[model samples]
Target: MFKRNIFICLFLALVISCGGDGKEMISLHPMQEKMAYADHETIMLELNEVSGLNHHMPKSLLIIHQYLNNETTSGFITNDLSVLTTDKVQISTINDSSILILEPSNNRLIQYDIEINSYEIISDQGRGPGDLYFAEELSTFNDKAFVGMQGFQLSIFDCSMDLCVYEKTINTDFNNYSIDATEDQIYVLGISPFGNPQDSDPLNSDHNLFHILNYQGDVLNSFHPAYDDRSPLVRNRLSSGGMIKTYSNKSLILIAFDFFPYLYEYEAGGDLTNIFQIDNFVQPIYESKESLHSGFSAGLIYGNKTVIDLTTRVDDEWLFLRLYERRNIGFDHVNVTFTGDEWYTYLAYNVERRELYKLGDDIKTTPGDSRVLHVLDQGIMVNNDGKLKYITR
Candidate 1:
């Protein structure tokens, strides 16, 4: 069953790419030379420009949460030092004074008003219209909130008023993992539909990877990372799903794969501009497997200490990445001892300086503790006592 699932995922990537509209696709390739690791250096990031981001540069600090072991938790500290905490919740800056939190566990969309020091559950939990179900991803565009939920559904809410009013829902054709929006478009990172796992030939197109949509859920365009031609590992849908963020003002879309140690930057119009890598680490080691019962070729992995958790954030002058790896974890049905403190590394690249820096190396931190999760606009978001807090310079 384990190997079969891996085969199914790879097979799905091929099928979905081939089953889409027969438009010509754009292929991406990484630079030949990888960025070398430099000495420990810290660059301070400031949230200065706040028009598209909807929040002014806070004088104090704000932080996000981290994914520890197998859990993701975080807290949001308002500019006034008010704290709103939840488990597995994603927060988006609705405005300078308000924020939207997507609490997936309770299926609640909460609007927290920092000025009043209060929060209200704006949307209820259900399968009905305007309800939030297992919603994880959240982004704001044009005074609206885009909530990506389970069952391949996206809920859009109007936040122009005092209360967010649900507008409509978008039913996507793929399994969306993360999302971001520009001033006019929504970028969804998802895997194509699982057509027939037994299908042998992979059509290999960009539409199988990304889906660009308008506010009305109309697919304006579809494209994948420009590296599919260089790396075959990206053909597996499971490994390709990662974090995607759009710098609206910059007109840039940054993509970081969970398993691949590389960052891709593209123009909003689907042009690959730059590729980034920390140190000389390119890819993970994998052993092939074959199923005897079903005669399925499972070739992704067997045992490897690969990147299981990844985060990417790009500021004006620097790009930040946090990579976590686990050991002795086999893809097959073998159990291994739970070894805490598997390896955590933090790296940053300065675009202007054209240098790479390593901030942390194999830090001895446990889960639900002080593990770094994300690189924020102005500070680093770390997990403290199971709650996410920001550490400013």
Candidate 2:
């Protein structure tokens, strides 16, 4: 995150009020406290026990003073970056000095030097001794690129050299939804295909949606974020509503759930720490489900559901969260677009202070499939016109 300090002078007025007894009192007022709208009543978050939290209130709010696409930002986006298609490139793993882009189609890893305005293709796609096959996940730790693919394969590419060299591959047993790592351990969000027997409601079978694995591809322990037993149809509706995102710092793992205003922290060795939550978000509707039609057809009995879809991108100091209230048809069944009270808001959780900061409604992350979006150290990748638009501090 590049910091260009813009100082603005403010006039502070002190008002002294004189009581009837001739006592003078300084007048004070509360600051804006309410963050945003929520699904239900605001659940006060009591985050008392947390460590390594150095959250500080922003001295100045961030604004998009410049845009970095293949243009502008004083040529920061660079010409080589223009070759990246919007569908193929990912901007989630960027830092202050460099920007990382992952092209899943070809299994290519690109890193752009922000200061020099240049790009380099670090990793290539292949199937030799150390190549990528079905590369579905990409994350960076130190100078290594962690690639997760089908057949439960985890590959590490050494990016210290000019071109990334495949170092080692760890085998696992998960169709990975997302995977990231630290120096000692790796975290995985595996997609479990669970279905009801026929049409009956399903019970909590103690399914583990979160998996913690060692570098050698062995599962140390699994976390079952259990939910109440609901019918498959109901479960399907609520499943897509909330988001489950993870963040790790080579040791500490922060797991955020959008169903409520909470984030769970864990050690690299799978020890649960503190469960952090925000006490002051506007309550959102979490349990609003209705049957579509009594008449049962094999395929399409169209219904509508609105969910508080939450997504997050983690940085060094702040874990950026974007919340969206999306209303769509159940299971994407009907081709017809369903619409309702769709809204979006942004919040930043200071990892150091263990506090939530309301990054005003000015700059926000766009709503999408909740895979790590175009996120940088101090900026967020804006949805652009077939181009990359980045907003930094």
Candidate 3:
């Protein structure tokens, strides 16, 4: 599968480099320095024995711990475990009392009602209407659920009531990581389906970046932000995966790159409004092409690269980013353990105030700290020794 994907990407690269439509993507310059938002308490969430996933609603908190195992536990933050599933699952909140758990392996969704403490399988597994397969990303906006599946497909379901019925499915061209929506428009963030011929270097080839679509999944506009050309092995490796969130009553969009240090803001009309560089945050160290193909496990890949684990929004004023920087540790040993040199940092930005602040002063990653799984209005949710904990201010 890896070789197949690489071949496909190479073929696409060649075709795009040769005959891609020369529609120039807009690039915006970034501010070199980031303004401090304010003094914030130190926040750190480290990985533990258990892996936890969570979704935060306005009035309720859902936690899933010991994931991808027979003993998986799903419940509210203030309550005991009420549900269990053997298959791996991703979750999204439909409301304060109900949530959807997607088992991508099985291509189905499980609806858990917090009020009655009951679980029900809501969607089936298939390519037909209302069915899902290999779904990776799920989110709810205005009572509608958007599910991003493999094969560059997006399925939309109306979950306004207790059950979610299939509303529509969108076949997208690019590979997307996250999805957001307002009342009338949907925003998808991912690598551009089309490559730029103007990019002189294949390593730094321009990615179309973000796309705006209507309820019908018709793309209205697309934006390509300015990024330093880097990745040596893959064309989109340096700028592919990122998170997008809607703010200011869904009139604006905020984007944070996984491998890059800049944050981008776009208007409703798809204009590159502002670009921000957080203070003390530097560019990521790219692994050499040979090192990347050296048979390292996912852990080693993460341990050797800088990555943004997650991004969240607080109302419309605050934007929070969780990032980690790991040491190279040398690629000599095929199977090596990660040392304690990794650093975890969180940055908070006040979009309204145009200020940014680092949440913690300590740069060292703590031992046995719970991994950050989700960000809520109350605090960060983590998994600690097979249990769930919320770190609040």
Q: Which 10-residue window in model 1 sums to the lowest lDDT?
A: 1-10
lDDT of 2 at 313: 48
List of clashing residue pairs for candidate 3:
37-356, 46-369, 46-370, 46-371
Candidate 3 lDDT by residue in tens digits, 157-211: 8888777777888987766667777788888875644335742454444446678
In model 3, what lDDT does residue 324 have?
72
RMSD of each: 11.2, 16.2, 11.9
lDDT score at residue 387, model 1, on the 0-100 scale: 59
* Clashes per candidate, residues 3 or more apart or on different chains: 3, 18, 4
Rank list by TM-score: 3, 1, 2
List the pairs of residues colliding in candidate 1: 28-226, 28-227, 29-226
* TM-score of model 3 (CA atoms): 0.63
Among all windows of 10 consecutive residues in model 3, the one with the lowest summed lDDT is 1-10
Alpha carbon lDDT of each predicted model = 0.54, 0.49, 0.54
Regions of candidate 3 where Cα sits further than 4 Å from its true position:
1-77, 84-91, 101-108, 192-207, 225-233, 248-250, 288-305, 327-338, 341-344, 357-370, 377-381, 384-393
